[model samples]
Target: MTEPQRLSRRLIEQVGCSRREAELYIEGGWVTVAGEVVDVPQFMVQDQPVALLEGAKAEAPEPVTLILHQGAQVDDRSALASITPASQAAEFDTGKRVLKGHFRRLQCLAPLQPGASGLQVFSQDWRTTRKLTVEFNKLEQEYLVEVTGTMRDGGLERLKRGITHKGVELPRVKCSWQNETHLRFALKAPEAGVFAQLCAAVGLTPLSMRRLRLGGVSMGKLPAGQWRYVTAQERF
Candidate 1:
């Protein structure tokens, strides 16, 4: 006889989904084994059966480290609005201002356009979020920008030093030339408001801006408007 194969209910646990979700998937005839659908959660097969589901793409279920490529028009208020209230409440208790403070502290690495997309990380807890935001202050943020006119050699350098705007001392940034038409710069605590300050400092309005990297993270292969879980190793 063929070797007896064993299966357990624990497979649902290992799949990083609730047993109810697993059961629903199984009942919906979405699960497959070696390319064959298995609609029964209690069904047993070999130690490993090729598992696939219609909407059950395997993802890193742990917390995520995000790298967003933001465009020119997106703002923080809109971005924060995308977060679901249910998820927010699950992560941090509702009706608690302290937790709201933690959420309010989430920062963006680049300014995004209304229609642009990039990477963004959601921390599992406030502590992890603080770590990522703090790391951004020390690390460099790179951007690929397009302006209205030709920029001088030191045009970017002036941005790196400091610029006063609206009677406020805007902090200096680290910038350099990526090409004659494209400028790259790194900033500490880059947020949506900083983009206006930068535009005022450079004396040129931003036509387009997209974040390329935050610290060592890049938006590699991640599609727009989609999210992936951040693993522990990817955390700051």
Candidate 2:
């Protein structure tokens, strides 16, 4: 019987590839041990047939970004905890493989306020971080706010024209009624508590707020408490 050895070493000897290349193949889900796929390059193997899957490449894995539909009651920490492999949305059609590494070192950008829910960004890519952090003011965030009480005539027009709060002028935002009770707001880099303040200024009491879009990305058909990978086609 052959002695057990690291799968990376076995692949190097079997296919005459470099150690790094072997590790890449294994980590990319290209290697199988005894017909079972094993992603860990350090897995021990002895006298077992190891084969590389067809079309396997030695390219480095791409950094991943995830969009989660945070629940209204769940806080940011709990929303992050729901990002396990089991919580990946069934409708997620991105061909990207779900790996343990994808969840590590993820930075949350644009976290929702307490009691609010909708699209949230989590990224392992520095580009995504830079876009959301350094250029955040340039991105437009869309929210659907449910409110009670009646708005005075021209309240929405006043909101779109801008308002003064605490003697400071607030930036202009596009506000319109989505329905009798829901207002849609397209705001740019709105500060915390600004939504409630604006609603109050307009004589409306906000009951709930749910973010629907940020920049070019929209939370379309993503069920609550589940997450999906940001596809290459997605800009934000």
Candidate 3:
């Protein structure tokens, strides 16, 4: 039979708490072992799981992905890093309750340019993160591109042909004017700020680039500066 380990050691490893935190839990009578309260930090815990007291720190909730509608003025990192009730936008807030685990580890996919917005993904599920980066080339991205200047003759055609950047070839993309100012583009992007580069090659100066969709997911009017949980019904 295996010998017992220190209670504080077991709690810190299992609960994702620090040594100090484990000691606090023990001293505060917030932890239990074998259906009994164990308040000694060095108490030997047998091969049994530790449980927190009722109304104490609860079990980690299901992992979630968040979608944020960022404005041109906001930094993408800052936007997701600090989310608060007062900062949330839209008619409703992301209904998922924030958990201690959620804030612990965050993997970001589809890094957005400073001015770019819509459909950015932040996930706690490692599978979601893996799918996005490993299979990103296979996924198509849609953008609402705004530009200034008259499109040169054959400019649209050239835009479709794509350009060579830093010894790498960017493939052709589908482009159509949304109206007079907005151009809708669909492509597989390898890097951020791709729209601006493509636009400049075709005699148009980029004003702003708003990502409308990634893969099967669409931004769908998520208010700017606001975020919501990516539903299980949604893929990608």
**Which numbered prediction scores highest in TM-score against the true structure?**
2
Question: Could you tell which candidate, 1 or 3, scores higher by TM-score?
Answer: 3
Residues 103-178 of candidate 3 have per-residue lDDT tens digits of: 4466668766557766677788888889998987788888898889888788777768876655656668999999
How well is each residue in 29-101 modelled by candidate 2, as lDDT tens digits? 8899999888889899999999999999997678899999998888777778789989998988666777777
lDDT per residue for candidate 1 within 1-236, as digits (tens), equals 33433222534645766766766556555567667766556777664554655465333222323333332355666655555423332322323212222233444533343333455554545566676655656755666666566544466667777877778787788776667656666676676656656765666656566666656666555444433334345434
lDDT, model 1: 0.53
lDDT of each: 0.53, 0.88, 0.74
Evaluation by lDDT, superior candidate among 2 and 3:
2
**Model 3: how far residue 33 lies from native, Å:** 25
TM-score of each: 0.51, 0.89, 0.65
lDDT: which candidate is best? 2
Candidate 3 has a TM-score of 0.65
Supply candidate 3's per-residue lDDT for 28.
Answer: 58
Output candidate 2 Cα RMSD.
Answer: 2.2
